[model samples]
Target: MAPGPAPGPPGHAAPDLATLTGVRSGKRSYYRAYVRSDERMQRAVRAMDSISRALVRTVEGPRGLLEEVARAAAAHLDASWTILALSDGHLRGARPRFLAVGPDGVVTDDDAGLAPLVRRELGAIRAGHATRSDDDGPWVRVPMTLEGRQIGSLVGLHGLDAAPEPGDLSVLRILANQAAVSLHTSEQYQAGVALHRRAQRLYDEATAQARDLEQRTQELRQAEQRLVLAHQRELIDTERHRIARELHDSVTQYVLSAGMAVEVARGEAEELGADGTTILERLGTAKQLSQDAVEQLRRAIYALHQSHRDTVSTLPELLHEVAEHHRPQLQVQVRVEGDVVPLTTDADHEIARAVGEALFNVATHARATRAVVRLRYRADELLAAVADDGHGDPVELSRLLRLERGRSADGRHRGLANIETRIVDLGGGIVFRRARLGGVRVEMRIPLPLTPTDRPGVISGLVGTPGDDRDDRSGDDTQEDPWPR
Candidate 1:
């Protein structure tokens, strides 16, 4: 029309100076078009900025990021209402599967507060009845896709005077696709956190169970040790009672029979008058010695026969029983000078045997009439002493004990040797001293905190006659004996 617009090259449109010059070319129609294009670009820039902000808002979690995306779409389309929803079967782990923004720009996960059109659109999206919209109606729908698969839609009802262009639809698609990728990432993060919590709980339970098992194992070990000790004690007691039975049935009867023979000989010697005087005197002495020997054998048998079950479990109570056995022939008294200390059962038995040996020597070789056994408990050691009123020399007895220990085992002074061995095995010492009661005093110093060795039958083997065989001696000749020949 003004020489007409020059025909542009082939299919290219004629360039508009209004776009290059902006407001400087004040033609009314071109200015209006320019203003429209500028506003659209500004809205697109704002929409892209919203997507950028939403992408970085992962710390606010999936729901917050989704809401931000919804608001960005609404602003881009200049919409009065908007809906963002995942299809029912898609992104099942994503929370708040549906999101709605009202005309008032209020965000909500539930569709109840949305406008009727917005709520209807959300239901359609959730029910899979809606897809990306391509109509010229006021409504616009774009798919939010992940890896090219449509998971949900971003729907909007615009309130603008102009319809959204193709460029506007492109911005909405970008925003929707970004929201899909972000939601998928949020679902994975949540799954990892839940798995970590469950794993920690199982580890704690396993640790507690292991600790309980260790404690029970230690208790079982301690119980096993106690059972072993108890079984050993039972065996020792059974052997002691057996030895007692043999001594009483065989050796005791032989000594009594020998005493009877001596009495008969003395009566025959008396009938011969002065011719038999010296022989009668010798027979009387032999009879007295036999009686003494019989009393000593009875005491030994009584001690061996005493059962551990029949008495209290204390050293003083055991010493009292030993004193009672010796009381018939020699007046024996037991005194405890301090508080009683507990010791191993085997150690107590050995100490009691040592004290009984001392009393036996007092009754036989010491020629003592009375004896006292004292147990004095001290800070570091136990003082067990046996004193008697007799005519025995301590020096001679101590010398004999040293000689017996130094020499070979020939069955002489076995009692003194046994006393030394018992005390020494218990980490203690023994001494023979002059008694305040006018005879020999045997003192045994056993160290305190006495945990005796587990040797069960050591002291039991030392009982009865030193050299004689203990196996059934009832058939042996009683006339060929050591009682004054």
Candidate 2:
């Protein structure tokens, strides 16, 4: 037998029959030991699995994660009841502070339905009196520590025959510490969410306040513009009243006295017979001219006395009024050809006065029977024209304007010069031509989108430029008669 069992393999020797028979008889004992060892290893693995599962429950919040931890400890030790509680003044933000799991796997955050032993362990852990590990009694206590400081305890009451081994205690400690860290993380997450909500609310309130402030600023600007316009109108009205008083009290009286002297002279010339024939005719003409001058002065006084506040506020309405004033003396038609453009109050007033002046020339000097006042609004400019059917010559008028501008500031022969000045001050030029209605046409071209520089107060340095006033008429009818009489 020794030779048969020898040298079974390299570096090995086979056992004898007696040794093999002894092993066969004690097979049951070895099998039982092996089975016990397998069960212990499986229990350790399950405990590790539970700890891993509990650690990842941080997203579930502190209360939920703590409950899972208590359940995991109970399952690991096969405990009749388990308690997990934070020590007093530790992890104060960790809600519910205490968590318990019964034998039936029911988890409760309150202590009302807990057994006496479970309640007592929870009270001790919360009171900060349960610090030491107890592995000798039926109740096992393990401290949940982080960085060498104990935050809480995990206590379990088991009905098992043996106390937990060193390996089992290690698994329990890991689960407890992991639970505490996960709870702290959950508390931090909640704090961040609350802060974000407060920031959003404050941003919304700030945006609303900014919008309200912008609206109030716009309203104030509009009110200021209205006040400025009212002030300008008041000044204009006051000046008009003063000029009317002067014309009525001074100029009208002088013209009337001159007319009376002319009448007396005409009566004395009639008594000189044939020698006084030419003198009588000349005196009669002078008397008639004086009467006309007095009549014109009276009309000016009446117009200046009328308050602009009682009249319409728009340019078209004012133009119509001007046409009405001349309708008695001549056939005048006002025609608007395009969408009316709104201009500043002063600009509109100046434009209307220029148009009125042209019409007055047509009525008094041009000896026109009919006239057309046209206002054409173009994309880039405005065309205001007064065309008349009369014996007026545009060439003579242009020459007169050049002559008048060259002379010193004299009140005489200022009608045409005044018209040129008004249009030029508004960034415009004047043109005179033969009208389709058989006489003169006075046309003004004003650029659109007028700026502050084009207003009345801002004068153009090239105002009296010879190129601004041009005669477009082909054949010149140079009549000796005074222009703009």
Candidate 3:
């Protein structure tokens, strides 16, 4: 255009100051673009490195991790201040804790009023809504999500020349992801520790309860043992006293009677002067009394060893012993009918005791010359009766039996109540009636089980003839119900 430039090479331009200057200026612009791109990549790498390091340090504590996240976000985003708020309300005491960081250090902001705003943003992000716009605003809200669950928010306040660029938002999003993972991991670890502590406390309480129960069980065992030992000692004492009373009442009385009979025989021999026949008769009588005493002694010794003996006592033998025991006091006779059944030791003893008591009462109160004991064995039961031939007041005897609480005038009524109790306990019933012999008759009937049971139970009502016109009293009057006192 200006007289044309010098001829240039084919398809090439001529050298000129303006062209050289333009080429140099293009190279400068390209170099400047490359340098700026390299600087941005380096800054992004450093920011990622910082985020990685901050996430690694999140294991220290929940508060420490929050503070680290806040600091890293503030520095990376070039913000005046950054806050990490737990929008899920995972904090203890249900109080919101906002961790804020600035360029200088950690700072406290009175953002209690902003809690509602932060929650709204977090809800919107969790619900998959578009992010809130804050292009020209001083506050930027970004959700911190993990596994697609929004845990909290990262709110930053800053004064920049322009709105946040895409690169800034990218870095902030990467940091938010890391922070969500770190915070979630830290919260999980804390929850695991709390659960473990609670389980340990419950285990300790159960162990303590087990120990106390074991101690109480041992104490109960010891107490039961002591009670058993005490019961055994009491039983031994009772058996000893019973043996003493039996010996005093039976053998001792027989020996005394024999001594008196010997003295009488000696006096009769003295009265028969030169009469050897009468003397021999008196000596024979003394010999018979001595023999009776010896027989009683033998019976007493047998009773003392009754526990170790296996011999079963028959009903006839029991009645014979009762008759023999009271032979000296009255003309006691025993009559047996039917087959004699074998009885238990307790039954035999109680039966014999009742017979002895009835005979003794006849001798002491009836003033009868003859007393008879009749025993009969039936298919399912046994019956025994003691009768005397004398006139005795049945009404007075019934009154005495009813008023047993009063002491007897002569102790003659002793053991009458015991006889009643023993026969009742053996599933037997006793009745007082007027005998055909014109005296009192005491009759008893006891039941036997089909299978031979050891335990004895009471059968209601007495089964026998009424004693006298005055002896007709109800069964209730004999057992639990008392006659009008």
Candidate 4:
């Protein structure tokens, strides 16, 4: 409509200026469209790179990954402030862990104004609703989800000059979803560790209880053994008491009655004049022996029972008494070979009784004209022996003392068995050997204190050996005294 172009050479028409202007405007439109497309592609590539970096932080655990997500979302969305809040009800009395990024890089607030909006997004996620931007403010909240369950919320605050686009919201959603997965994995690991610790504690307690039960079992076994030993001791004491009663009632009474009979016979023989003098003297001796037997019986009964506080006589005097009483019945000589010492009551009684039993064996069993009673007192021990000039076998006497047979036909074996029992009970020793007097020797030794005491007490006598109760009158009637001067 304005000017015309000059026509070119042959066949060319003149160009219109309006047509040239329209061509230039079309080229400008194409250049503008190409520039806009290139910018959009660059933005897409950056968002993709941000999401890849946030996912890589999941290896550092849930808390670290959450922090990374906040930073990445802030840069990608161009926000003035960003917050990532996690709320897992598993922790005791736990509140949400909140992380934020601001213009200065990182920021935190306990009571932030945007906290309510973040919590609301979390509620929406739990309620199965889509997370969206707020219409009232330049902020956006997106749900953090794992396997379709909401774990927390991701909230971003945009600057006054910056508003979020659809692409910005999409990048935040990817970060929140990856954070939820990391949180779930961390929770499972913590639970497994707790369960292992609990199991170990239970095993330790069970081991301690087992040890206690084993110790209790051993104590019970020891207690049971002690009870068994106590019961055995009680039975032995009961048997000892029964034997004491039998000797007191029967044997003692019989010996006393026999002594009375011998006295009566002596009286009757005295009426026969001069011929009865020898018979009366022999009867008198028999009566004396019978009384001695009765005394020995009483002592044996006492030894079998409990001790008493009654004072006793000295050891030498007690032995002399036994010799003096038995002299009329048998020709017995008393000999003392060492210094005399006092002894405890039980030891004194047992030693004197053992010597008496040896002498009685010579009188009742040995066919000898004379016998010797030797008492040797030493610093450490008291030794006593009785020997005869008869033919008693030492081996046979030892067998009888051991009670190889219950009782002899003559009832003499019981006496020697009693001697063996008494010697063993007193912790003494006994032996039978050939004597210097050419007959059986019954020797015994009793221990004494290394240092003598001032206390003095009497020794008691024994009745007879086990095999010598029945009188054997085969020895000659000759009487001789071999006692030391």
Candidate 5:
């Protein structure tokens, strides 16, 4: 065992009482000092109170406690190495990181405990038991406690020349106790930080997954539109063929009879010889008009077949019509970027109508002086945007779409439903947002040659409803003007 404190001349006053009470040990030395000393116990208590306040103010948690104790021990005892260690529920480190100091006045982590006396002393400190080594001035360890609960340890090596007096040892124990409380607080704080990180990771992963799913859904919708377009074109061709047979059976007979009547009248006029020239000219003009109708029908059939040879439409021609008709002062712009496959008739029709609707919405809602229209032909679909510079929030576009459904004056309403429905039918959609110009903006997209296989049930469900047998005859009359004053 380590040698006891040498019997002292006069009473040995403790150098630091804060350490003694904090460690929950070494009360006997203080009790003896209080009883025989001329100074009252109150004076000792007052001095310790000041030291305790200072230690508490500087400490954070167990880590702070351990560090403070080690620094105090190292400076007072003048030992080459002083260390304090505590586990954070992990046992991997060969030595604890709570605190450590090495010989030669240098602090290092890799030091091994070579003396059993030191090990036993440290073990007792962690276990809330005070212990001393066998050397004359050996290492001492004492457990730091708060409210009777063991938190960690305080350790110090007593150099041969710097053995601690009873009062000094008591002060060291008190510091150890305070350190234990700080360590517990720090551990709890670390645990909270770890949990916050885990939660953030989960949120990021979930957001990525949602975006992936939305992209896949858009692709599927585009494919379905291609399939519906093919079916509609085929049906239109069949209906035209049927109409051709009807024209041959009914119209051809009527036209031939009428031409014969005209010929007979012309002959009569010529035989009469008075107004032959005028009568003959009238007959010829009527015959020419009849023939022109037949030729026009023939040309329409050729125009329909031309799509098979060249699948793309002349987009500039289509937009020119809308631009030509647009109101003055509103600049309608159309820019085609690259080569893209021609969209089906329905897709083309729906896109055009949606764009027109977007323009209408802009004209009524935005009070901007100028507006811009943009069209981009990607490899897959047609993207069109109608934007105005009146007022626009770049993101709050969906709310505007809802407003379009509501009524203003005269109970009149804006028809966003037409735009949305048509966009959806073409395997595309419209989204409203702030335009680059500072006004309301509307974007419309339609996939080319959309296929039903992309959305198997959709084309079958929407195009051919339960009682609808005449798909060949069904088509939108979008050629007619939407607004007629």
Candidate 6:
């Protein structure tokens, strides 16, 4: 290759008026060839400038530098094809791809077709700021040098008809060198963008997985809860059967035996007189005791029955309704006060039902003419109290605490033991004393769990806020532990 004008076949002068296929004659043909050659040079120069601009643009955006530069150059240079390949690696356009123009107007920039030696030479040429070539002169790789460093190479074909000029190749080299620098910057940016996209996709996937996992965990918890409830019901059913058997074996037999003895004494009364009468009286007492036993057994069975709707039980409504239900004969007044804010995540339906049971006990056993059923909700505690307008007898209260059997002053049955046991299980306390109305008052207080807040929110009662205690019972409030059960 030489640095000079390209040569063509000599032109022949002919008659000015001569005519031929799409031409006047010899002189016109020569003029056409000269114009074509000049156009080729102009196109090559424009292509080089386009390559420079394209490289710069690729660095600024997502477009691959090599692809943009090579494709543009091929079009501008009026070549049939163009390709850009990386000097550093294979067919990667994002990595300093170099352009090559063939004499036949065909370009092969595919990294796959490029020879390994050529690729190595391009890399060296870019790094060392020098050009290298193979043994044959047909292929010449012009190094694209910038700031004393060869970023890559530009190769052009040489044939017998066209001997590559040094000046033209140099021009190509300068443009290629500019493209190489721009491509290097663009490649770095491209790699960074790829990394960022990968990270964002991972983050999104992780977030979706977390939500799915949480949903699965909740489903598992629900399934476990159902299993526990079913098991509990089975146990209750077994207990009921056992209790029914006990009642038949003990209380029923005793009542039947006592009746037989009374009948026998009546039959012998005429002969045995006073002794027979005494036997009959003793049998009567025994029968009465047997009947009382039957009643107690029934109550026990009622307590043992398992509820399927346990989860849906609303303690306050149940309590208030019980008080009102029994208000007619007992002259009991049902008063519901305070707040019991329901929590969505709370699974303590048993606790609420237990509270309801306690209220039921008050109406049944307290033997009061008037009763005040209070359900108070403070920030820190939930309290319920059933006070009665009955006699001031602390003896019944003591018996309830001891869970011992003692006849009620009114000669009615008492349910104090069950009530006390339920309240104890609620982590609460109870106080039994004379009310301001001059009658026995049974007040029970249970602490509400603290809601999530910066300060110990809602210390007590409905008036409880961050630092308020409007419902803390004064002087007569007693605290009871719920774990004894």
Ranking the candidates on TM-score from highest down gives 2, 1, 5, 6, 3, 4
Q: Which portions of model 2 miss their true places by more than 4 Å?
A: 1-41, 47-67, 85-99, 108-127, 131-138, 146-148, 252-413, 432-485
On residues 111-176, what C-alpha lDDT tens digit does candidate 2 reach at each position? 999877667777789888764446445888889886788888888887655777776788788778
* Model 3: per-residue Cα lDDT over 45-124, one tens digit each: 77677666655663465555455556666765567667666563442322224566655765543454344544454454
Candidate with the greatest lDDT versus the true structure: 1
Residue pairs with colliding backbones in model 3 are: 432-467, 433-467, 434-467
Candidate 4 worst ten-residue window by lDDT: 459-468
Q: What is the C-alpha local distance difference test score of each model? A: 0.77, 0.75, 0.62, 0.64, 0.56, 0.52
Cα-lDDT of candidate 2 = 0.75
The reply for model 3, stretches above 4 Å from the true place, is 1-40, 55-59, 89-97, 107-136, 244-485
- Give candidate 6's error at residue 131 in angstroms: 13
Show pairs that collide, candidate 4: 312-458, 313-457, 313-458, 314-458, 412-466, 413-466, 415-466, 416-465, 416-466
After superposition, the stretches of candidate 4 with alpha carbons farther than 4 Å from their true spots are 1-61, 87-98, 102-104, 107-133, 159-170, 219-237, 243-485
Candidate 1: clashing pairs of residues: 1-4
Which stretches of model 1 miss by more than 4 angstroms? 1-27, 50-59, 112-116, 129-137, 219-234, 247-401, 412-485
Best by TM-score: 2
Worst 10 residues of 5 by lDDT: 466-475
Q: List, residue by residue over 1-485, the lDDT tens digit for candidate 1.
A: 12345778998998766466765354567777777888888998998887777667767887777887889889988887878889989877888787777778888886656666566677778887755354534888888888878889998888777888898899888888877987888778878878888888888888888898889888886565455445544666787788878878898888899999999999899999999999999999999989888877777777776665533446888788778887877999888765666665667778998998888788778778899898877656787899999998888998898788888867556889988898888889998888877887888988766643555545344431122211221212222311110
Candidate 5's C-alpha runs over 4 A off are 1-65, 87-96, 103-106, 112-137, 145-152, 160-169, 223-231, 244-269, 304-485
Better of 4 and 6 by lDDT: 4
Q: Higher lDDT: candidate 2 or 4?
A: 2
Give the per-residue lDDT of model 4 (tens digit) for 128-170: 4555656746767787767766667777776524455565567
